[model samples]
Target chain A: MEALLAISIGVLVAAAVYLMLARHVLRFIFGLVLISNAANLTIFTAGRLTEGMPPLIELGQVAPDPGVANALPQALVLTAIVIGFGLFAFALILMFRAYTTLGTLDSDEMRIAEPREDDA
Target chain B: MSWLLTIPLVLPFLTAVAAFLTRESDWGRKVSVIGNVVFLGAAVLLFSHVYDKGVIAGQMGGWPAPFGITLVADYLSAVMVVITAITALAVSVYALSDINTRKEYLGYHALFNILIGGVTGAFITGDLFNLYVWFEVMLISSFGLLVLGGSKAQIDGGVKYVTINLVSTILFLSGVGLLYGMTGTLNLADLALTVPALENQGLVTVVAMMFMVAFGVKAAVFPLFFWLPASYHTPAFSVSAVFAGLLTKVGVYALIRMFTLVFDQDIGFTHTVLLWVAALTMVTGVLGAAAQNDMRKILSFHIVSQIGYMIMGLALYTPLALVGAVFYLVHHIVVKANLFLIAGVAERIAGSTDLGKIGGMYKTAPFLGILFLIPAFSLAGFPPLSGFWAKYVLVAAALEDQAWIIAGVALLVGLLTIYSMTKIWAEAFWKAHPEGTDPTLATLTAAERRNLLLPIGGMAVLTLIIGFFPQPFVSFAETASMQLLDPSPYIETVLGEAAQ
Candidate 1:
């Protein structure tokens, strides 16, 4: 299961990087989303998948049973997911605004901040 | 002790909340200034506490060490927090004149304070995960501040800045994950204990490189620094000034911490890479600055170069070398931020930061000229200025190690820095105004003059003080470096007897 997940992450990251290299901002943002999901999966796979019950103890038990999965990475990935989602949402809107105001989605021509040699 | 540690982080947050509540009123500016003063007081208090105690740790919510989030301050963290407060105060005062009303009602002060809070949190955090959270907080608020005006230039700069930083964030997060998988703990103190025991030292080095790239982007090193000059000249001068002072320093701080405390194994391999990066960063940054005609753009590129000097100290990883890094960190923050503030004043009087367009400052506004000279000379490594001492320490550290190549690079970079500073001085201050009008201080209204010059004068005075009184500051950095070299005290303070 870990091997399969790792391969999937590799594929997702490859696709994301390919998309990220595109000239358009929206495509680049979509690449960001894919790469972010791949990062999430990287964390999950790196933590090592286990076939076990949830990390919950019985009423009188002091800890989860010995066969329980490692819950820490899950918690970490969940936090990353939430933060990544918020940042992606913000990035989407920001790129949308850039599209509207700059009137060009092409990253190459978005040189208003740093002007090109001949243009300046 | 815990109270002291928490105050620097908590005060600005409280101020941010309060300032946001009153952001629509004129009171936001008032609250920001007062909040900065309180924050500075709190930072001084924390500094004194850390000085006396050696290292102090406070567990959040009374949880035990390595279990709950810990706020730790040794000498380096203490000094950094203190400097952040100082920069915040300086920028807040300068913002009174620089930030117009539209940006103010957009909650400029609130975002500014939150950015400070995030920087403070990043400095003091004892958990790697906690540091990531603080970084996100810093990034989000900085995004707002960067794009507040939403001008064509700002939005363009904002897109590049935000996109690149988010990529760095992902790399940082993934590095944290890979590290946790190896060590089974995320508390820095705990990781410090476990990282050495891991059998896969090669994997450890890989993760370290991940951290290096993640932070390398933030620090704006060599090839990774294109986003900085593209974006920094777009923000409000006040926003740009604080960012100039605090943002890159945080990345350098993280590099120092992890390199010193957690990833001390295989210094031969890891630090050698850092040494090369340092040289290239310095060379490229100054070369880039030499080509720029805009005042802020030149200063922005110079920031990249100066970061090279700091990282050079880190790459050396000696006791005296780390001291140089610490000293340079503090001194550069003051000098760089003040230079930006002065540029804003010049822009106010002369009407542009473009060198070809603005001039006559030495003839018409000698006071402003003097203020600009302090930081400009200091930045170029001239004597009796803070930049001199900063560069002196680093070069001396390099010579002490008998690293002739690094010593040469350091001094050569200093000379190139002088060229850029002179370019600014000659074009912006010495030459007659191209439009044939003398740019005088009187052109600014009374309130504008008061608000603008006060912070510029105040920071120039600080540069003078640090320059003239280098003894105590050097000794403090020496002790801080000693603490960094031997972080057992820091680890013990955070994790108790288990650290041993």
Candidate 2:
């Protein structure tokens, strides 16, 4: 199961890299979303898969059963997903604002901050 | 005992709440400044606690080591938190005049305080995951600060800055996951205990490189620093000054912490790679600055170049070298931030930051010229200034290592740094204004002058004190370096008896 998840992560990352290389800023945001999801999966698989077992402790038990899944990575992935979502949401709004004001999505054409010196 | 650690971490959040509540009134800015003054007091108390004690650790909710989250401070973290407060206080006072009411109404003070909180958390966090949380806190607030005005240039710069930093953030998260999988613990103290004992040491090196790249982007080192120059000049002067001084150094601090504490097993490979990156970063950064004409852009690129010296000190991995890195970190924060503040003043009086358009400051505003010279000359490594002592220690350490080539690169970079400073001096200060404007300090109102020059002069005084009296600061850095080189105290403090 871990091996399969690893291969899928590689595929997702490949797609992310391709999309992020585009000049359009929206594509970069989409690429970041894809890549962050891939990172989440990497963390999930790295925790050593325990199929179908919950991490919760049984009633009157000292701890969760030995075969239960590791809960730490789940907690970490959940935190990461939330943070990544906040960043991408902000990035999306920023892109929309850039598009309206700068009038183009192409990163190359966004030169108001660092204008070409020769033109000046 | 833990209150010493908790006060500095918690005070900023409380201040942010107050500032946000009072954002519409004049009381908002005053509250921000007053809160920072109190925050600095808390930081000094923390520093004194660490100075008297050794490495100090406190676990939240009373959970024991390697389980509950931990907050720890040694000399390095203590000094960094103190400096973060100092810079925060300086910038908040400057913001009294530089930030407009529209921006204050937009919660600028709130975001600024939160950013300081995040930087403090990063310095004191003992858990890897908690550190990631702090990075996100810092990143999100900075995103707001950078684009608060929503001007054309700000949004343009914000997009690039947001995109690049997000990528670096993901890389850092993935590295934590991989390292956790190997060691099964996210506590840095625990990782230090387990990383060397791991069976697959080679895989540990791979994770180390991932962290290096992640933090290299944050530190704004070579090949990964384009985002900085692309965006840094777009923000308010106060925003840019704090970012210039504190942000990248957080990256360097993380590099110093993780490399020395958790990733020391393969120094032969990791440190060598860092050495090459340091050299290239210095050369490329200085060259990049040479091509720039704006004052802020020139100063931004120098941030990258000076980072090379700090990284060089770390790469050499000697006691004296680490001492140099620590000293360089503190001195650079004051000098670099002051230079940006001076640039703001010049922009206000001269009506532009463009070197070609603005001049006559030397003739019209000689006091401003003198202020500029203190930080600029110090930045160029002139004698009896902070930068000279910083460079002197690093070069001396390099010579001691007998690493002739890196040492030569270090000196050449210093000479080129002087060239850039001189370029700014000749164009902006010595030359006549192309538009024939006087650009004198008298143009500013009395209140504006007080609000602006106070921080600039205060930091310049700090630079001079560090320069003229280097003995105490150098010894502090020496002890900090010793703690870094030998982390037994840190581990024992964090993990308690189990570590022993």
Candidate 3:
């Protein structure tokens, strides 16, 4: 299970990197989203996968050493996911505005904003 | 005592919400002023308490470390918090009249306050994940503030700035994830303990490199710095000044903290890379500054060059070098912010930031010229100024390590730094304005002059105070450096001895 999760994360990271290298502005935003999700999975896998374990609490009942899952990584990942969502929304809006104003989504075409010698 | 940490972080956020709600009233301005004053008092109180009682840690939601978020304030964090508070107060006051001219002044203030809270939080937070969250807070607010005035130039600059930072955030988050996977912990103190025992040294190096790249992008080091010169000069004076002073330093601070604590074992791998990068950053940054003719653009490029000095101290990794990095960080924050504020005043009087279009300002605004001169000289590492002491310690450290090449590069960078400052002085101050220049440009209104002078005076006085009384600041930096070097005290305090 751990191996599978790790491999999945690796693939996700590769896909995210590929998306990031694209020139389209929207693709760049999607790349960020994919990268963050891949990161979340990586953090989750770091805790060493365990099965049949409930959320880190113990109840009064007979159970076979109810090896609870690691709660710390879960908490951290949860916070990161929320923050990543906020970043995604921000990027989406910014890209939309860029598209409307620049009349193109190509990152290369955005070079008009580059510093010109005459600008100084 | 730990509760004092909440004041700097919470007040600005509360003020921001209040400002947004009361967006149309003078009451918003009053609230901002009151909030900043309270924040200044809190910072002073926090500094005193930390001086008496070492580092302070606060666990949020009543849960101890490993479960809840922790805010830790040591000498380093406290000093930075104090700087943030004082600088924010001065900039806020200056923005009172300056920001009102724009349609989105209230929104700008909201974003500005949030950015301050984020920077202060980043300095104080002990949790690694929490640090990233605070960075996003700073980044998002800065994005809004950078484009607040809504000019075509601003929107253009904002696009590049926002995209690059977003990419950096992704890289940083990915690094954090990989690190958590390897160590099964998110707390920095916990990582400090666990990272050393990890088996795969190669993976640790990779993670460390990722952090370097992410922070390098923010710190504007070498190859990753192109976005800064491209964008920093497009914003309004107040926005550009604060960003110029504080934003890049946060990145340098992260690099210092991580390299000292988490990646200490990867020294052979990472330190060498850092040394080469620092040298390249300095040379290239100076060359970029030399090519710029605009006052702000020149200063903006100089920021990247100065960051090389701070990174050099870190790469040297001596106690003295760490102290120098801390001192340089403080001095650069004040001097750089003051220079940008001077640029604002110059632009106000001359109607342009371009050096060719701006001349003879010293004839009319002599105080402004004097204000610009102090920091420019200090930034060039002139004697009897704060920058000189910082460079002296850093150079001494490099010599102690027998890193002569790095030392020579640093001295050469200092010379180039002086040249750039002289160019600004001669072009903007000593040279005569051309005939037929607008007469109105020569006159400064009473309110405008006050707005310009107040912040510059505040920073100039700070530069002088730190220069004259270097012992206390040096002692504070020494203590902070000690905390960073042996983070055993930090880890034990946060996680208790049992966890370790």
Residue-wise C-alpha lDDT for candidate 2, range B1-500, written one tens digit per residue: 88999999999999999999999999999999999999999999999999999889999999887999999999999999999999999999999999999999999999999999999999999999999999999999999999999999999899889999999999999999999898899999999999999999999999999999999999999889999999999999999999999999999999999999999999999999999999999999899999999999999999999999999999999999999999999999999999999999999999989998899899999998898899898988999999899999999999999988899999999999999999999999999999987898888899999999999999999999999999999999999999999999999999987677
Off by over 4 Å in 3: A56-58, A61-66, A111-113, A118-120, B101-106, B438-442, B497-500
DockQ of candidate 1 is 0.79
CAPRI accuracy category, model 3: medium
What would the per-residue lDDT of candidate 3 be over residues B1-500, giving only the tens digit for each residue?
55888877798899888877666777666666677878888888898888888878788878888767888887888888888888888787777756763544438777888998899989989888899999999998998888776666666678778888988887888788789879877778888989999999999999999999999999999999988987889887888889999999999989988899899997987998999999999999999999888999899999999999999999988898899999999999999988988888788778788888878777766777777878898999998789998898899989999999989999999999999999998988878876436423237677766766788898999998888788888888888889888887778777877886
Please say which candidate is ahead in lDDT: 2 or 3: 2
**Per-residue alpha-carbon lDDT of candidate 1 for residues B1-500, written as tens digits (9 for 90 to 100):** 79998999999999999989998888999899999999999999999989987999999998887878899999999999999999999999889989998999999999999999999999999999999999999999999999998999999999999999999999999899899889888899889999999999999999999999999999999779999999999999999899899998999999999999998998999999999999999999999999999999999999999999999999999898999999999999999999999989888889999999999899999989899999999999899888899889999999999988998999999999999999999999999999999999998989888888888888899999999999999999999999999888988989998568
- Backbone clashes per model, in order? 0, 0, 0
Off by over 4 Å in 2: none
Per-residue lDDT, model 2, residue B244, is 98
Residue range with the least summed lDDT across 10 consecutive positions in model 3 chain B: B433-442
Clashing pairs in 3: none
List the global CA lDDT of all models: 0.92, 0.94, 0.84
Top candidate by DockQ: 2
